[model samples]
Target chain A: MTSRGVRHDSMRARNLAVVLAAIHRSGPHTRAALAERTGLTKTTVSSLVADLLEAGAVTEGGAVRGGERGRPGVAVRLSGRRVAALGLEVNIDYLAACVVDLTRTVRLRRTVRADNRNSDPALVLTGLRDLVKETVAQAEAEGLRIAGGALAVPGTVEDGVLRNAPHLGWRDVRVADLVELPFAVDNEANLAALGELWFGCRDADFLYVSGEIGIGAGLVVAGEVFRGTFGLAGELGHVVVAGDGPACRCGGRGCLEVYAGQDALLGALPSVSELVDRLKAGDRQAMETCERAGRALGVALTSAVHLLDPGRIVLGGIYEPLFPWVAGPVAEVLEARLAPMRGAPPSVVVSRIGGDAAVLGAAGLVIQQVIAEPGRMLGL
Target chain B: MTSRGVRHDSMRARNLAVVLAAIHRSGPHTRAALAERTGLTKTTVSSLVADLLEAGAVTEGGAVRGGERGRPGVAVRLSGRRVAALGLEVNIDYLAACVVDLTRTVRLRRTVRADNRNSDPALVLTGLRDLVKETVAQAEAEGLRIAGGALAVPGTVEDGVLRNAPHLGWRDVRVADLVELPFAVDNEANLAALGELWFGCRDADFLYVSGEIGIGAGLVVAGEVFRGTFGLAGELGHVVVAGDGPACRCGGRGCLEVYAGQDALLGALPSVSELVDRLKAGDRQAMETCERAGRALGVALTSAVHLLDPGRIVLGGIYEPLFPWVAGPVAEVLEARLAPMRGAPPSVVVSRIGGDAAVLGAAGLVIQQVIAEPGRMLGL
Candidate 1:
């Protein structure tokens, strides 16, 4: 009898998850539409929606007009005021925090520029903590309850530990220990990819290339980041682009980072803004530098495309601003190298969210948990 | 009322699938063990097992004693004799077929050497058809029923249509139309990886490098082949290893295939066998040729490792025979190039299945379908 009761409960939970996922993905949906989408009966959908409404996870959103000459149905949506997720990101030069409601609306956002490289971990983390605390308070003031938080660090993170952030000169830092909130930590590139999936293009599979001081990529497959077996996937910066080019800090020759990383670009220009301005003014030197970087990036990305075969490639961070100058060379090299038999080349686009992608994606991590197990978040 | 009935049937099917998967993965289990593993009650497991027995999908073995002097329980296993799957392959130089029982035991295997480059699709397919027919007849003679067949071709395949086998000079050939069987067709590399998963190490994620006249790769993630958006992932041969080296047939400079492909190796020797013999005899020219190829392969593979981060890389086809000479340089470059932050390098191993991986994998595909929907296989 106990086993049967457990089985029944699990079935209910599974049904609840399905209904929640359907509404979350294609929301403003009527019960009838949800039933059709999830293959649940209308009655089952109604019962689940009622349970979610009572749990404050969902709310009715007026009437959704049916097709012409048909009766209208009441629309339902995830409740924005009931719960929120906090996102935090620590980059070499900035610390950012954001709170997003259940409907993925930004309730609070804060960013501060501080050279964190070579700084004490305690000092850097303290600044980030203050920002997160402020955001949490702001979100609560907006009548939103914080469900959880997640941190995005520019480094190799595993199980909430920031292991070896080369750019920040930090190693083996327990991120959760520094922040008082209950939070999950992941690599910034990984979160950026998730951010794109959640808020940007919502592509089922693509490579999210995050360009900062160094270039990294996040492999997203079926709407989830494809973290390799040990969470060490998508390290695109060090992919050798030229066998005999310049040496890279990673102790490799002709790495993609050496050719296209921010430091490399800056070596040829005064600043990124200046470089962009010059390019816009049709400066020959700036154009040549950007084009060379683009081609090298294309060379490395061609390898990525061949290996992963993503449907699209989203350029985030610095690349987003540099895309116009880079896209042509990147496409030319990719077309030249990728097998003609592969039909069309994968689409490459600039990230819509830009620098905020990692922080927003960090919030998405919490939202993902709530979606996976709404009962836990609802305390049911 | 009808919807409730449909839901109930689906629930039953789901439970049946769970039980079947458990047995298939870790079989020869007692009813109690199945209950513990599947989280189903002993009574529920017994009933499901009984149904499976009635459907001839499972059979009881002799009772096995439980640990620590407990009462013995009857052991159950899949009924291997009740079903079989056929596998077929069309390579650049060979056509092969294999049959395997549900227990993954090969019942019949055949391979015929025939250069298929620039060959007429109809004639090549006819030769393959004859080989498959002989294997099917042999399997039936051994008292096994052919569940289905899958064909492995070396090129881009989409929905059983060969879009372009550049090596074979074939285009837009519908494989199913060429064969009269309830069959599925896929790229040779994809099948080889699946074959490795089903019969070799069974790593949840790995890159299976298929080294033939041209190089290809199969990316497997979480026990399934990761075919990119359009099924054109894993074109590893075209990955640029040298930016200014010789031009490749794929219209790329310094592609891995240009330096490591069979043609490249054969260019320096009489035959693969003779090259191996010369290397074994410590011939300087043979050693130099093999070493150069290994380094070039290493260079290309470094790019792959940085991008995908597969848990293991299984060298298949020609690479298997040449692994001893190649593995060293591949490891050297991977270790030197991969970021130290990524922890240890992925394990590299030669495929244990050797040349028969694709054929066995083709058979495995059919078996996989049966395992996924055992009810259909059992005529339930």
Candidate 2:
């Protein structure tokens, strides 16, 4: 083929991806809306949509009757078939795998209990492979085919090596090789931020704090997770809150995690789920513990606010339910502490995705990779 | 002009600006180097440089001698003529102004002690205007022509309004109107981060925490200040370190600043500068205070590291002296807290700019704006 032909084909593919991404983000919109959103000409949008329709990547929904028009406007939506991606979220004590379709819907999911605190990379990989196999099989049964997958771990991963996974006790494990899929691995907190950016806030500057066995945060700026140079930007649990406080797993004392994370709470009380359940059931002790955690978290969030000035903060992970128990104390601490900006503090919210944030974010990584332009892929 | 002619002219102007920026950054490189750096043709660089020289915006230096010479290669450098930018730094008890040439050299400087604390917008503006005029006069005497200026303020500046300047005791002041110079204003910490990114670190991922009367941090991620959505970020001092510690100016108790900031130390011991001087003279009590401040600052830096994963933390302002005095304890705290990575903890360093960080950064903002696009009057 001629070089010009190759260039034209790449441009067409890029425009098609833009159209697909827009639809995936906004669900279904008219051709005019798609053109406007993607900044593509009508002719370009039409050509791309026609190609997608032929490839079964998108399908036409029936005409809408709302608008005043000489001709009815037809809606285009991502087809439920043809392409799908998988997400794997490996926590300290559990594993979650999900199959997501082109429309950004989870078609299949499976969760399994697994202890990854033994520092054995093999154990985590075994759990991951099993989870992926189970979820993919379920998706296959449901007639959803998976094209690729990505995993989210609560530690630093660089060049496919799991350099640190405090919760899993895994260090320097070859993540990509272990997963054995055309996949990418990212820090869990980073994914949580992306999860909220994609599905929760969509257009809000957000800080997503993933509180589990260890605590961490993800900063979403301008609708994207701000991953720092080394992929370890969200390790907030280790931020020293108490200078001479108790030593943390990361060796820092009086860190927010030492005060508010799952391990700290579990060490102080019974299992986290028990306390959370009791807190939800209005147990005074549980409520007080939640409040204390919230206060510590509030202090951290205040710092987060002072640093990034995000619009809102999204509390996610297993600790999200503690928002009600902790929000008041956190808000109180924030109001008392923050340089009052016109009498209001930044809003703090709970993650809408509940426990599915990391896995969904992992899935999003695949989608972003598949659709991103070469210029963006260069990591600039 | 015809529509096509106008469009062509706009493209030419943009390309010329690109060429100029490349030369300004890389400095005195051969035509090949400029073309390689800017992805422009050697012919384009030659043409644009000629135009710029003719316009008196640029001047060529002596010939670049040394490479296999058939026709001698000519070197180029900024003439430091045509226009000058002013930078104003507002300190708690003083104001500093500097005039920088297009070649990025400080041609003139003037500092005056002013009661900026508790000053109104008009007072601050008047002070800044007088300082600017003085500096402008100084620059003109030195044969430098003034063009525009930027002010560095220690508060959240939104639409030219100072939301709050606690040290200055100013609130909701229209800073832009007050300082009637063709200028822009931003948080001092952000500007410091920009300065460090541009001139100091250059390639280092660092956090610049301004430890003046209040505590603020500027995050440099991938060689740029990672300003959050509303441009308010890097507020490390407010991170609640002690839940029930001393009250802070921000109305919060037990903030990092309450333990580590200037006012906090002064309130605890009184005669802060005297104490610092005594410590320099090897007074044990004064050394203890500095050490305690370092510990608190270290705790805050831990949180920043967790959140940013910066390669280094550049402490600026009056905090510079504390680096050596506090480095041991801070490193101890960080080592105790950071995640067990294969490598050592991120390096913490004091900024080279010392007390002049804000003014240098303010000047840097204008330099960045002009250098980014030489043809533009200034950056917005």
Candidate 3:
């Protein structure tokens, strides 16, 4: 073993990652700032920066101004443009894609209308392939190189096969084979949760619910996405809310989706978009529909809160307009039911990324996968 | 620096403990059997066994005469009687004490009436001290030695303090200071979950619901109890089931416990013991009460299943009497409500330990704390 044993090597990698990640996260910094932020020795930080620059993972920019008279320090910054990534968000009606740089900044974005009717694996494959091509083309036109991408599918995908997508009426679609890029596929809700963790609700452990035609949820625990065994956790909308209520497409009855999902609210009204317009126009009927949906959502939130005790619930979906109407009643219902030790009722917040939470989450997945060196990112 | 780096030493200790734990769990085993069971090299197993024996953690036993002609091999087993652990189960009306061996076998058990009025820090401390003394006396009279003990309180406990005991109406009772033994304290539900994992179900990811005066739950995920931030996980009974329904002692309305807890069931009946007695006697009113409780439980279970996707649920406490009467309906309701992909409605099973599940769980807490090496119990 080199002077540093394999054990020491792992430690070194972790320490290096911490320093580099700090620089990458906080922008250019002097050695002293890095040490203060990362709690690493000056010698260790300097050594890690040298290695990162040698590997072309980081670059030194202009020297710092107004520093001590000893030496003008180089402002070390991450070489973000040196690497590229792709992020794909799959929805029931459309596919959204983004090209992100190493610094996690989106360089290019594109979208394609998707027909989710085709349960045929080949059709789904073709749709994904065409979308990737379009995304890559958009990135190239914007002068950004492509490295790898991640696909966020609105279904349970295990071992590259989409096990179920109730809204899309799709099953067993081979996600990896469909996309030619080095890609990772995960549940859209889980990705949305990661997006919330990475860019939206930092340091929050809560539930992210995507209430579209089909409802799904992502659980964030301690600032990380919590994917249970088989990656099928956080399907909150599928949980039965009414014992003898309506039937769900997934063959369950009284599911949260059957009560509060996008289709359910729309079915209660004339049209979904029309209902949104009415709510915007201060129509009482639309407001009542949203209130009923909120009550059902409150019921489901009670379950989520009881089971996991998340700190908050971030609402994401086509029905984002209903959030304002529903938030207060949902909180009231939750606080009215929760146990005393459970802190206070969790806040019900709307998605910070608006319609792009899933795409941003998908992009986060690519960054996580490509920058596999967590040890190198955090100076342990 | 200390022969092995801190991290590497932790890894080695963890690996060694894994082998030892495997042998300890499965009982006396030959070197080859331990190696096979623990997935460790035979040489590594031998070395580990030697270390354990030298450390007096294990003792040699007679060989199991095999059918083969290979030389008779000695078996190594944890010297259960050589080390002792204690468990204290503190309920609202009673205290149960248990002395367990190193191998997690309960050797002595005793109980005494307790009351919430005695929940003052000094009184609780004195009472627990007396109980531990009496239990240790019993063990000593039986020629057994004591090492350590743990207290399992029916409340939220943190840092050896009882943060909240709703049934006892006590808050922040510093328990470790009161007990005159090497002792630790945790929420009873968490202890019950550990008990189920170690002794009852043994690695099954099941929810253990205690439905006595009040309802509480413990979550076992991938064979480990999931203690949420502040150890408030598995507080399912407190999750609101019927919004705007009834006022709870916890100052919440419409909690699951308010709908299905023992007090809730008893309030619907004549008395607590009468409900159990009538259920046993097949009284129609008691049976109907149980069925209603089961339905409410099924609703909560449906929510939990959607959130956690555990493999099964182990029902305990006062709810156990309802187990035979309610299991069918609960299963039927859960099956009817759950989506198939959540993995065939998690089997609803009765706790094997029945009324003693809590006390046994308390014993499990002690065994987990005193006997097992620290590193092997990762993710606890």
Candidate 4:
């Protein structure tokens, strides 16, 4: 293409992205409203809307009344039944898959409980493959075409490879080669944070704590996951809370994981649900254990608050179910340790999306890519 | 402007920014080299260079002698003598100012020792005004225009207001109102980190630890300081390393500053220089004090590494002079506490620019702004 042609095409793509993002974020809007919102001319917005409608990426909705002035304009929204994204997750004890439409609604979902901690990588991948296939078929049957997908791994994932998942006893697993989809892989905690950002609170900056078999944190800055220089950030579990405490699987002493990880909590209580039941029933042992765990979590998070100074801290995974039992102790330490000089302390809240955050976030990754380059997604 | 004119102007500005950034970062280069580097046509590069030359932002240097090529192209470089930036710093015991030209050469420098702790904000601002006047006069006399300036303060600054400076016993001081200048105010540690990034190592990500009367840190990510949601990130001194250790002035127990802050070290020794001299002379008390302080710093930094996973850690301020005696202990604790899953521990080193980092960083802030919008700075 000539330079002029290239520049025109780039401008058109940027305009399409702006229009699509406005619709995706603020729900249905008319072309006139979109033009006003995106600072584009009405002609440009109308042309882009026509292209999007023809591409089946958007659809006309109910008419938007113009306050008894001009003609009522047709409202446009992202096509919910046409395009969908798949989210897959591989955990120590479960394989899960979910499909979300353009409107961020779950179209299909499945979870199979299986102890994959001691399972071979090939076997686990095969199980996850079957689950994904089933979920994709369901979405197709429901008139949704899979735009793209992502995998959430509870491990250090880099360039489609699962480096290590201590809880699953897996290392160096090439997830992309086995998944058989145009999918990207990332740490589950990172995905959970992204999920919270897109589907939970829409906060620009916060710490999303994922308490699974091991504790991990997702540092979100300006609505993006802050992967450190080595892509190994958010290792909250390994932060030493005590100088000479119990050893952690990561070979660190007195790590938060030693006190608050799933294994530690489950060692005392049968299951998270059972612990919640006992806490509601006023069991002294359960209360003490949870308080202690919350304190350890608090200690680790105090360091996180100081380092990141996030606006909020969202507790996900098991912590969501255990928040009622843990909130007091966590808040106590945070209030005491956090610098009072900096306005009010960051608010601590339970994850609204709970356990589904990673799955939702995995789907969000595809949505983000689509929004970033609508022309590519539409094959324009 | 019309839409077409606006688009054209924006495109030109972007192309100019690309060309200017290339020259600033990679030093002088010919038009051909810049075009190739920035992926722009040679004609476009020439046009942009002409504008920059007219604005006095760039100057033609000696002809480039190409090996095995056609007619050599003339080299172009950023004009050094035309523009200068001023840096001002307010600490508990000193007021310092510096001026750096476009090429980052220090043209004027001054430091005045004053016990500003417990002093009135109006009086301190008056003193600072005199110091800044002296520095600016020197720079003006050298035939350099002051493009802009930034003030570094040892406090929680919000929009030019010093919210708190426990060490200086300052709070709610309207610094910008008191001192006249087109300057932005920021924490000293943050400025120090910026200074190190612009002038020292130029690492993409690192923690710049600023050890003053109280310990503070600057979290640098992707060459910019990562001020958290509230612009209060990198409160390293207040991170609770010990739950039951000495109380810190920040109201946190077992903070890194309680063990390693300049005041803590000076409490036992006469002064920073004397302590450094005693450590070099093998004094048992000085060695032990420095060692313990380093250990506490390591403990706090271990948390920092786990949370942010920076590639390197740079020790600045008072820690730079004490690095030789303290590096061993800091490294030992860091190595032992840092999670083993992440390949190797981040390298810890003393700041190359020493105590002048914050002052240099204040100047860097102006340079960054200038680089970001050269057209505005050049009155184009």
Candidate 5:
């Protein structure tokens, strides 16, 4: 089948990307192991590794023993320090940015609080642009090249456009048009899930629920975000928890948002942290609110478990800090309602990346692109 | 970059399977198209197609024009009639069996109604075995060879074992031991969804809700049944529709099953068809019951759409004939509740395969295996 008329350069480029992916996803492999695993010849593996090293996509270290055969051999791993990406986020209450490298590690992070609700999209983009540019300069000063970038907006993003952000009162905001960097736009929850998948969690399949002013979730199936046909897969907040409970902003009754959204749980409270503080200080109302929110979340997740069957549910954003107060009730509802055989109900857990998951995940998306096509990133 | 010690026979066998899949997925292709799509040489595709024809896995026909190109050439298609599979189902009230072929076509079907509720697992399997044997004999007399088989039970199935069938009063029933065939066991809803995927519907992603004595769903994502982390993904019946509506059999409050299950929807009524007849006669009580059930189902699907974001929702089993009475209220709920940006809620539709979806889908599973590895089916 001698390449079947395929271009030699493109084949080599694909092989390079494959080898890089092998190292990035469970790496520190010796050249011999990579050759065997990838089914490429030892000579070809050597040539590709040489190209990768020259491109600073991978680094080879001294003999790394204690493996399948326990024979000492030089090890190769990701040299992600050389290439990084910028992640920008515009939330209702804040604007954030971070730099993530090829190894899927967060290298720099910063957040600034602001009253962004009902603010003009252009004004918000100006503030976000400043934050991202400064962070990119900082990352560059540390000797990292910006390979690609993405912005995580708390909205339904499609074709690099933020279609809507209810909390921010934004509609059809194209952040890329205003931002200086060539960053694409994406949904916040989706990026956070990607961040957890790439940087924090070891499991490939799980649900990452990002709790902000509005609750949204990212359905991660088979290691990729399960974006629906319309690319708007996870909108957990809108799922009806009670068929006749209460009126919701989305013209729905008894929606999870009406019960478990930040505003619902924290009325007039500045932040989730303050609510936690009140609960810790033995405030009965705060404790009741947390319990009620947890129960509502559990009801919504019961439907999610039935529909998606994710392995685990990671609560990110506001839910992360509030996990101690919420996870117990969520798990309780799951155990009682879910059929005993759906396997064990999905284990509820906190996002290890905390509130910064979305921003870091956005940067991780770029790093993913770089690792998936190293030749393209390195100009071949 | 040769074969890397991979066996020549294995590679050729894989190439044969690849060509067969190409035809089965989107077929009636000329040899040139097969070669182009599979990245195999024209000579290689010709050799593989020759082997497939020899194995009776494909049929070469007269010139079939009108395709991507209006050129005239002999077209290759699935010779599924040569190898068929037996699909058996054991639902709460009936046992069904069907024969499906490599082309995913149902050649024959039969159903026997019985009070399977609270019946002994052994007695039920015996009846099912007899039905399957007769179906196999009938299919054999029609010149079709049974290559493989599977059983769809109204319960949880894992590793060819019926772990539990609550409606059937069965637990740990290993039907393969009694059925004199190499029949695998699977959940009825999962098989029904697969049946719809392979034989009825063109779309790959959908939620096939099988409304029976107990409502269950098959979550089809990326053309495969998404058995959750625990292989019990589409337990839509147990998904909380009303957080505090009523105590359910699963010991949960406000489960969709409590409101939408067969017994709940029909009560003293005998069957869904009877209810439809009553509704046609303008029976006020019947119409009210269906509307209420539709509202409850709509509430459950709202959660499903928000979490899974399936492109479509297919209601099978009893819901097929009942679609006229229920789909309106379901659509109305979706239109009212779902966030406008989640990209228009999933369109609700009836199952094209009618009530026999599970049995047919079960057979399609075996046909899929045959197409995937034609050599194995041919005892290579």
Candidate 6:
């Protein structure tokens, strides 16, 4: 093609994305409305809609009506079925995968829980690869083409490389080669935050604390995940609370994880359920332990609140189930510690999506990529 | 004017800004170089440059060197003389104002030292107005026109409303009407961070801590100040240090301010200089007090470092002068507290500009706005 033709095609590609994004964000709209909203001519919008329809990124839905001077017309909606994305997670306790379509609807999911800590990366990745293969096979049966995928790991990730997963004892591991399709790797905490931003009711700026064997935090600022300079910003578990307390797994003394991590709270208990049962029975030791852990979590969050001034704080992982025992002490510390200028501390809430937040968020990231360039998805 | 004509003018106005910003960021550039840099056609760049020149936002200079084969051509530089911006600062102990040209060079400055604590807003503003008047007169004498200005207050500010200046005991003060020129108001710490970004050697992501009577922080992320959800972020002095140490003026107990604030560091010394002299004389009490403050500062910053992961930390205000005595303790605490994942802590440096940072940042902001839309500055 000539250079002019290439430029023309690129311009149309950008306009197609602009129209699709408007529909995804504001729901369905007629071609006339799309043109008005996107500041493009109706003829151009009609051509772009045709291209999108051919690419299976959009479909004609029921007639829409508007207040403006215009006749009711069929609406263009984001209901693509031919394209799908995969989401995978590698955590200390589980390996999971899911397939999601263009509408961000999960088509299939499988989670296998196991003790992944100190496990060999090759063995763990084999399980993850098998799970992804099942998800992709299910997508194929449903006539959904796998466009891309992403892996969410609990570690510091950069450029599809996992620098370290302290709980998993894995470092410098690359997961891109495990999947047949194109994929990205991201820190699970950041992905969890994105999940809250996409799937949960809590939108705006907030911090998502993902607690498991290891504690991690994700900062949602200005409606996006702020990963910081090294994509390692929200390591909340390492915030020094006791200042002279026990050393943590991450090799930091007096870290919040020293008190609030699973090992710290559970001690020799086999499972969190055991501690939950004791708390439910009003066991004094369990109650006191939870309260102490809560205060420690509170101390760490107090510093986080003052430094980031997050609009709200969402506790995930074990904190979600333990919110009853921990919220009070957390609130007490925040109320007493936050400066008067901040009138009242933000509410501490439980995770709505729980453990699946990261995987779902990973799928949504792929959906975002497809929506951003439907022309590319169609191989235009 | 016709609607099409209005759009055409607005497009030109935007293009004018594009050209000016290119010149400001890249220094002197020939029209051909600008066209290549901005991906605009040579004819378009020439037209935009002409508009900027007429707006007194750019000056042509002789420039003839290039790697690519081309004829020697005059280069356009950001060196406007007629249009200047004003910067004003209100602190606990002084009022300051400065006038700067389009090139961000300060042409004149004035500072008046006074006890502004608990002073009436009207009285303090009156003094500020007088100081601004002198600065404006000096600009006028130099044939410079004041296009706009901004005020930096040591408090939380939004939309020109000073919500509160904890150190000055002032609230809900408005300082706009005091200046005749178009102006804006912002938090001092945010401006000081901007000052460091524009004037100091440090660029990219860094946190600038402005320690006066209150220790406020300005988070520079992605090369801009991140003023949290309510534009009230960076209240560092109020970060809880000791869960139950001492009640602070801001109604928080065991806060960092209780240990690290200017009052806490100076104690009964009456001034920072007295404390500095005592420390110079090897006074044990002074050394111990500084050590405590440094540890507290380090603790609060550890949280900030984990939460924001700023690439660097700059200590301004009193910390600059007290660097010799405090840097060691601050570094020690940070080393003991930060996660081992972060191999080494970000270097803690002292502010190079010191007191002039905020005022100069305010001026630079005005200069930026004028450059952003030279057409608006010229009233086109």
The i-RMS of every model, in angstroms, reads 4.8, 7.1, 6.6, 4.9, 5.1, 6.5
Q: Write the per-residue lDDT of candidate 5 for residues B1-380, one digit (tens) a residue.
A: 21232234556666777888888878688888888887877888898889888877789895585676566667999886678888888887789888987777779989999999999887877888788788888999988888888888888877777888887888887776656555678899999998898877857899999998788898787777777655677888987888998898777789888998999989898877788889999999999998999999998988888777787999888889889999999999888887454547788898898877888888988887887777777655
Tens digits of per-residue lDDT for model 3 on A13-57?
A: 656666766775657898877876876667777887887776656
Over B23-120, each residue of candidate 2 has an lDDT whose tens digit, in order, gives 66566766666666766667877887787777566777676846685876677666787667788888777889887777777777778987777777
Our tally of clashes for model 1 stands at 0
Candidate 5 per-residue lDDT, tens place, A74-116, comes to: 8999886687888878887789888877777778989999999
Chain A accuracy as TM-score for every candidate: 0.94, 0.87, 0.85, 0.93, 0.93, 0.91
The TM-score obtained for chain B by all candidates, in the order given, is: 0.93, 0.89, 0.88, 0.93, 0.92, 0.92
Best of the two (2, 6) by TM-score = 6
Worst 10 residues of 4 chain A by lDDT: A1-10
Q: What is the interface RMSD, in angstroms, for predicted model 6?
A: 6.5
Docking class of 1: acceptable
- TM-score, candidate 4, is 0.92
Off by over 4 Å in 4: A1-8, A63-74, A176-182, B1-6, B63-68, B174-182
Report how far off residue A209 is in candidate 3 (Å).
Answer: 1.6
Error of 1 at A170 (Å): 2.8
Interface RMSD of 2: 7.1
lDDT score of residue A196 within candidate 1:
91
Go through the candidates in order and give each one's DockQ.
0.42, 0.34, 0.28, 0.40, 0.37, 0.34
TM-score of each candidate structure, all chains considered together: 0.92, 0.83, 0.84, 0.92, 0.87, 0.90
Please, what are the lDDT tens digits per residue for candidate 1 over residues A1-380?
Answer: 11221266667776777778877876678888888887888998899899989877789976575745577778988998678888888988889888888899887888899998877888888888788778777777778888888989988887778888887999989887655555799999999998998889887788999998878899887777877666877888888788877888877789899888998776757778877888899988888888999999888888888888888889988888888998889888888777453656787888999988999999998898888777676665
Tens-place lDDT per residue, model 1, B1-380, is 11221265566666776787788887678888889888889998898889888766678986564645667788888887768899998987888888898888888888899999889999998888888778878888877888789999988898889999888999999887655556899999999999998888777789999998889998787777878767887888988887767998877788889899999977856678887887788888877777888888877887887777787889988888888888888888777766454656787899999888898999999888877776665556
Residue B311, model 4: Cα distance from true site in angstroms: 0.6
RMSD to native, candidate 2:
5.5
Largest DockQ belongs to which candidate? 1
List of clashing residue pairs for candidate 1 = none
Cα misplacement distance, residue A144 of candidate 3 (Å): 8.2
lDDT tens per residue, model 6, A334-371: 87766466778888888899878999888877877777
